[model samples]
Target: MKAKVYVTLKKGVLDPQGKAVANALETMGYKEVKGLRIGKFIEIELDGASQKDGEKRVKEMCEKLLANTVVEDYRIEIV
Candidate 1:
């Protein structure tokens, strides 16, 4: 089984990197750009785990280490 995790800043949190990229895009003439945010993507492989178990483990991983729960949110996909 494989698990994919997406970690992103919570809404209302400041994202300096994302802001910088957005500014750069505007400077380069992409005026339509309005907002941006940065995030992390993680992929994990699990051997012999059922889908339920894989999802549970992935959620734990995100809560414990993959995401900063105070300022970030994470979504998980199991395959």
Candidate 2:
């Protein structure tokens, strides 16, 4: 089994990196860009766990380390 975790800044948090990228795009003639946000993607391999258990473990990982839970939100997908 495999799990994919997505981590991203929560709304209302300052995203300097995302802002910088938007500014660069504007300077480079990609003026159509209105806004941008950046995030992280992680993939983990699980050892033959049931779907329910995999999800539970992944959620724990997210809460413990994968996401800040304060300034960031995470979504998980098991496959």
Candidate number achieving the greatest lDDT relative to the actual structure: 2
**Tens-digit lDDT track of model 1 for 1-79:** 8999999999999999999999999999999998999999999989988899879988999999999999999999987
Measured by TM-score, the strongest candidate is 1
- TM-score, candidate number 2: 0.94
Model 2 lDDT tens row, 1-79:
9999999999999999999999999999998999898999999999978999889999999999999999999999998
CA lDDT of every candidate: 0.94, 0.95
Model 2 lDDT at residue 19: 99
Kindly report which residue stretches of model 1 are placed more than 4 angstroms away from their true locations once superposed.
none
RMSD of each predicted structure: 0.7, 0.8
Q: Lowest-scoring 10 consecutive residues by lDDT in candidate 2?
A: 45-54
Task: Give the runs in model 2 whose Cα sits over 4 Å from its true position.
Answer: none
